[model samples]
Target: MPKQKGNLWTTMWISYLETCLNNYLYSGIWFQQFQKIIIPHSQSSLMTKRLVAYFLINKVLEETIRGDYCKNKNIQEQADPTLIPKTIITLNQVEASKFSYIVGWMLFKLIKRDYLMNSHPKFSVICILLRSLCTEKVEYDVLETKLQTTIIISRSEFVQFMYRLESLVIELFEKHNELGSNILRYVENSFLTNLHLNQTFIQILKSSNGENNSELENEDCKFIYERCVLIYMKSRQKTWRSVNNYIPKKGTASL
Candidate 1:
C-alpha cells in the first residue's frame, strides 16, 4: 500500500494490501468447477481463507443489492440487476456458518500478529473485527479446549492492553456513533470481572504507589486504574457498594 493510499494505514503497525480493502485484487479465483456443485470447506492457508471469505461476502453483498433492487422494482420490471439471467448462487445454512469462522480465523491471525492495532482500520472494519474477538457472554464463559493456548501478559503489557481496550470502547461509542454489543457484552461479562486482568491492574497500581516502577507512573496508567475501578462498579449492572481497602489498591472489585 502506498503512503497516500488508506492514510498510509491509520495505525501503521504492519499491513497487507487488503487491510485497507480498496478494490485491490490480491488474486484471481481459478477453480474449474461451476458454482452448483461446490462444497464450502475450511482452509488453513490465509490465501485460501481469503477466497472462502470472498465467496461468502460476495453472496451477502449480492443478496443485499438484489433485495434493494427488488423492493425498488416496479411490478412489471425485470427481476435481475443486469437484465440477463445468471446462475443463482445459493448456500445451505450450515455452509453459510463456515464463512464467519473462516474470516474469524484470519482476523485472529491479524490480531495475534498485531496487524489491526498498528494500522488504523476503518470503523466498519473495526466493527467486524470486534465481533470476532468478543465471545458470547454467559453466566460463566465456557472453559477453553486444551488445544487452544492462553496468552500470558506481563503487568506492564496488561496495563497497555487494557488502556488500548478502553480507548477502543471510547472510539466506537464517540466516533462510530454507536457502542458495539459484542464489546459491551465483553466489558460487562468478561473484562470487568476477569481475575487475571483485574489482578494485573492491581499489581501495576501497587507497584506505582510503592514507587518501585517509575515507568508505570504515567497519567494514562493512572486513568486506566481509575477507569477500571469505575467500570468494576458498573460490572454486572447490579446495585452495589464499594469496599475501600481492597479495590483500587488490591486490584479487587469494590462492589
Candidate 2:
C-alpha cells in the first residue's frame, strides 16, 4: 500500500511539472506526457484522482485564457479584465458553464474527504485558480455551483475553507467590486438554501466565545468572522443575532 502511494505521489508531481511545461511550450507534448504518466495509475490512487481534476482545470483555463479559439473579435472584447493579458481569449457562456461543472464536481470530492487540508500545496493552487476564475463573469455559475454542492462534514476543515474563501472574496471585491458583489450574492443564496451550512456557521460563531486562541486571532479569521456576520444578516434577520460579538474590535489587530 505504501509503495503504491509513493508511486502515485511521484506520478502526480511529474504530471504537475509537465503541466507547467505545457503551459509554456503548448507543443502538444502534455498529451503525450499524460498518456505515459497519468493513464496507467489513474484509477488506482487518490493523488491520481486529484491530478486528473487539476489537469482538466489547467486545460480549460489554458484554452479559455490563451487558446487560438478565443482570438475572434467578439470574444476578445468580452475578456475579463482581472485576468492577466486582457487581450487574451476568454471562455464563452457555454464553456464557462462546462468549466463550472468540472470545478464544482472537484470541490464536491475534495470537501467530502479530509485528505486535502487548507494548507496543502495543491489545495492552495486550487483555491488560487478558483479565485482567478471569479474574475470572469461567465464563471460565476461555477463558483455558485461549488458553494451549493460543498458540504461541511468536519467543523475544523469547513472553518478553514471559509477562511480561504473569505480572503478570495475580499480580494475579488478589491480588484473588481461588481464581480465581488455577484460572488457574495451567490454565496448568500447558497447559504440560505443550505440550512446545515448556516447552522455550521452559527456553531463556529458560538464556539469562538471570548477566547484568545491563535487561530481565531489570525487576520484571516478576523476578516472571515466579519464576512460571516454580513452573510448571516443577509440570510437571516433576527434581533437576537450575536455573531458580531466575535468580531475583533478596532485596533485589535491589523488585517
Candidate 3:
C-alpha cells in the first residue's frame, strides 16, 4: 500500500513538471509570433503597440526566468519533473536556453534602434515594465544577478537610452500634463530604490550643463532638463524615505 502511495506521489510531481515545460514551449512560440507580427510593424496603432509591449514584458518574468533557470546543466541533470509515468523524457538544453535569450535579444533590439524612446506611450509602457521586472524578487537569485550584470555591462548604451527616455518623458508631459505626471510617478515607484540606475541619472543631469549647454538652449531641451530635475529630486526623496524606514528605532534590537 505504501509503495503504491509513493508511486502516485511521484507520478503527480512528474505531471506538474511536464505541464510547466509544455507551457514554456507554448509561450515561447507565441512570443515569437507576437514580436514578428506586432513589434516591428510601424503601422501598428498606438494602443496595439502598447498592448504588445506590455504582454511581452509580462511574459518575461515567468517564462523567461524559468526557461533560463533550467538551462543550467546541473538542473537539467535532475529527474524530469514533467515526465509521465513510464515515459522517457528528452531534455533539450538548447531549446531551453533560447527562451530567455530570445526575450533579452528582443529587448536589446528595441533599445538598439531606440524604438522605445521614439514613442511616448510605448516608452512609458516599456519603462514601467522594466521597472517591475527589475524590482520584483524572483525565486531564483541567479536570474536577478544575471539581469543586473547585463545592465552594468551595457551602462553606456543604457545611459544614452535614458537620455532619450527622459527627453520623451518631458515631451509627453508637455503635450499631456497628466500623462507626464503618471510617467514620473511610475519611474519613482519602480526605480527609486535602484541606486546604480539612480546614480546614472545624476551623472547625466550634472553633465548636461557642460556638454549639452547649447542643446539646453532649445525650448524642448529646456523642458527636458527641468523635467529631469524633478525626477531626480523625487528619486532622492524616495531613497531617503527608504533609508529611514530601515533605520532601527532607539533601543530596538538589530536583526
Per-prediction backbone clash count: 6, 0, 2
Tens digits of per-residue lDDT, candidate 1, 1-255, equal 336533224223223433443243333332323222354453366566657656876676558644543433332132211211122233367843442333333333333433433363332333343333333222433575435343322233333544443333333222111212122332333344444444555564444334334433344333344444443334322211121111121222212
Clashing pairs in 1: 10-120, 11-118, 11-119, 11-120, 12-118, 13-118
Q: What's every prediction's RMSD, in angstroms?
A: 23.9, 22.2, 24.8
For all predicted structures, in order, the TM-scores are 0.19, 0.18, 0.18
At residue 129, give the lDDT of candidate 2.
28
**CA lDDT of each candidate?**
0.36, 0.39, 0.39
**Candidate 3, 82-136: lDDT as tens digits:** 2212322232688434423333433343333444244534344333333322222
- Off-target runs (Cα >4 Å) in candidate 3 are 1-117, 120-217, 242-255
Candidate 1 has its poorest 10 consecutive residues by lDDT at 239-248
Q: Whole-model lDDT, candidate 2?
A: 0.39
TM-score of 2: 0.18
